[model samples]
Target chain A: MERKRASLKFLVTVMSNQAASTPAALKHTPLNATHRELSAKMVDFGGWDMPVNYGSQIEEHHVVRTGCGLFDVSHMLPLDIKGANVRAFLKRLVANNVDKLQVSGKALYSCMLNEAGGVIDDLIIYFMDESWFRLVVNAGTAEKDLAWMEKMNADWDMGLTLTPRRDLAMIAIQGPNATQALNHALPGVDSITAHLKPFNAAAMGEMFIARTGYTGEDGYEVMVLAKSAPFFWKALMEAGGKPIGLGARDTLRLEAGMNLYGQDMDETTSPLESGLAWTVDMKTERDFVGRAALEKSEITQQLVGLLLLDKGVLRGHQKVLTKHGEGEITSGTFSPTMQQSIALARIPLGIAPGEEVEVEIRDKKLKAKVVKYPFVRNGKVLI
Target chain B: MSIPADLKYTPSHEWVRVEADGTLTVGITHHAQDLLGDMVFIENPATGRSLAKGEECAVVESVKAASDVYAPVAGEVISANADVESSPEAINKDAYSAWMFKLKPANAADVAGLMDAAAYQKLVESEAH
Candidate 1:
């Protein structure tokens, strides 16, 4: 038993180091050469050598807010689960209710939780049919999430066939003109995607197009063959979709009040406290993993949006002092649209919107106001 | 990318230009701004504040991350650039022209101890590898 435990500890260390590997050992997406050709500034993001920006990250962000921007999101894993029991399996696998997904191609955003009520990863589940489902998970947590799903599959005796779609590459075309650029790029995609609403997907040939995005904008997350990524990227560019990088992606998401996996929450953070309580579907009688723990857990903290009133920029891990208690900023960035700094903080409960809070930046405490998030959506500033 | 031969540099990437009046104008290097991506905010040390050599006296925050600007030599800050603080993107436009602060060095000769253009260029190259 001691030897087994020692080997388990070693395995955990090795797995965690996958994203901390040296630059030489970093992984590359299918569009690595394309990014290099575009003169993109590359950085080690979750062990993947990915582009941070082509030029000004703020400009790229504004482009996404106003016009069309293309992003190579191939690093995120596309997992397909197929079986007669696929729906049954997912009913207990994730926190959200799968029953809401009666219509085919409908997508549901959910948080997969551990037995301890901690979030494993937030993912988008697309119901293709009663027998098949597709899930898009975060890049950094792909391996561990897959392992967890595989373990649960066996433990529950659910004989579903899980396939990691590494052969596919995803591109997110976002902004107000996203659909126009997408239709221009693919020519006939408009006919298929024109009627599709948000949180819906459609498959044309081998490509999967979902009308969903991380940035709170009108966009589609299109998946194509990995070998065809560069061609698709070039086509999108020719169709007036400017290539955007991860740096802009981050700022855009923060302004949109989205949670990043590692930054906002992790294996130790519960979905209740991570501003994902709405996605947790506790009203359903269907039993899911972590439901018991979530039922018994006392909610002490709640995630809220903060608008920095001071001149400085708010950053992650900064202390947030509220009248109720102290909290920490999970994700923070300068919202180019608002021309102000915004952040998401997990503070003690009872700090209502419109209340003032102090965010400690270095030695000084800057004033910030608690506000309802989604700071910018579809080029409009809400707060 | 542009390391002016007349200017001096610190290992931390701050570039110092000695003015005709024996004062020094300081800003981040072009390479530093390139690495930090788009500029968002800047905080310069208060004017007349005494600083030690290599003391972190200013801050330059880009969209990607926040970095410190150290005092190249023991000095008193004479002026802070309000223009750059208001429009921090000026640094990305031209790092040398968007000086963050001015300092009256305790010893003007201390500028000679900092890295020259060629030495700083070499240091930046070495760091990239």
Candidate 2:
């Protein structure tokens, strides 16, 4: 297993080297030049040239947990669906209940699934009005999601107009000091955002601000015109927001127990086994995509959190040995806030929290304990 | 970034420093630490363990991923650095000073065949492109 892991690493290195040689083929975000100006280390993330870190990824992770950090999430696609039947179209498209979003500026987290109950993507849907609803989808799956939604619109005769908002840029300001820094950056905007609850959004002309974030902290995901992203980023920095790269963003989300779209659940995995069952609405009588398959499928595996008791760091794709059967880690990392290794693993059922499991890291089988996740939130360790 | 003139380096990014006691100190190069980002965990080879040339004898894991540290030459591990195990960020601070282990070369002539600072710098530059 150790040798296999080494060979896989070598293959990845070769692929990345090839990608570096042809830089023009990679996509760049709106803040690409800004990241370069900050001397960030760039890497090819799903065909997009993204900043992994400026310097010391661990330090950047700490800054987000303790203070304020800003992230450029412009790679994610924010789509607008318009027409008279927008809400009806969404009810049949997503697995979650769209009726729950009765109030304007409310958001619902849901999984768009294939007919076989496999997740195509997990997205946040923002309801603006009966005829206008906005959705934020993953960057890597943007094109596929649009095609699927278009096909559904035509087949269902919803006659909705789906517009992919590529002309906009998104920035997430996160941490305990997030509100204070944002208020300082954009004066008087606090009056609209201060009362915004979690999973709620508010629109100020073309600019949209949502009180939602991947990191488990008080923050906002603000959207603006693509041309003004650099200026907004600079203002946020002047207001005491540190530039955080994707590396720290990853650790923070993992510590928060948030599921990364591709890493945690892909097109081959179902929401029932990916710790997203709550997001899937089965109590309603409304017919939606993938509902029939979900009802028929028997769940044999479950996603659980693993805390390494040994010294080595946990990593994805490592074998997990439980008493029931073998399992695999979906997302794993060294938690900067907890100062320990934590992982989300898809293990066999019947393994409860606090049970012991052996994770195969290289040549050694290290001891780990199953625990409820959200390992760290608001700079506090939960387990 | 800093490839000391007095030290030798391997293509895999391990740096070697010859000591007055005839033993050699082994650690990763500055360029290696810079590429790997922040170090969070390290595992060194056991003392007295014999290693072949280019053998994967140690590990240096950053927060992002884990990387294998190869033995620079055929040697036996003399001692491992306990301080680095407890606080791996020392390597990120100064890769040269925070040596991972001490090795006694099986053949002293092997150290002479290693690349000098100028050659290692050229190799790093080539890899960057």
Best by lDDT: 2
- Summing lDDT over every window of 10 consecutive residues in candidate 1 chain A, give the lowest-scoring window: A1-10
lDDT per residue, candidate 1, A1-383, as tens digits? Answer: 11111121122223224323454788878998999899887777877888888998989999999999999999999999999999999999999998899999999999999999999999999999999999999999999999999999999999999999999999999999999999998978989778999999999999999999989899999999999999999999999999999989999999888999989999899999998988999896889999999999999999899999999888888899988889999998888888889999999999999999999887789999999987988888998
lDDT score at residue B73, model 1, on the 0-100 scale: 96
Deviation (Å) of A188 in candidate 2: 1.6
Individual DockQ of the candidates?
0.31, 0.46
Candidate 1 CAPRI level: acceptable
RMSD of each: 6.0, 1.6
Q: Quantify all predictions' global Cα lDDT against the true fold.
A: 0.88, 0.91
TM-score of chain B of each: 0.98, 0.97
lDDT of 1: 0.88
> What's the TM-score of each model vs. the native?
0.95, 0.97
Scoring model 2 with DockQ, what do you get?
A: 0.46
For model 2, residues A1-383, the per-residue Cα lDDT tens digits are: 34534421343344347435565788888899999899888888888888888898999999999899999999999999999999899999999999999999999999999999999999999999999999999999999999999999999999999999999999999999999999999978889877999999999877999999999988999999999899999999999999999999999999999999988999899999999999999998989999999999999999999999999999999999999999999999998888899999999999999999999998899999999988888889899
Residue pairs with clashing backbones, model 2: none
**Cα lDDT over the full model 2:** 0.91
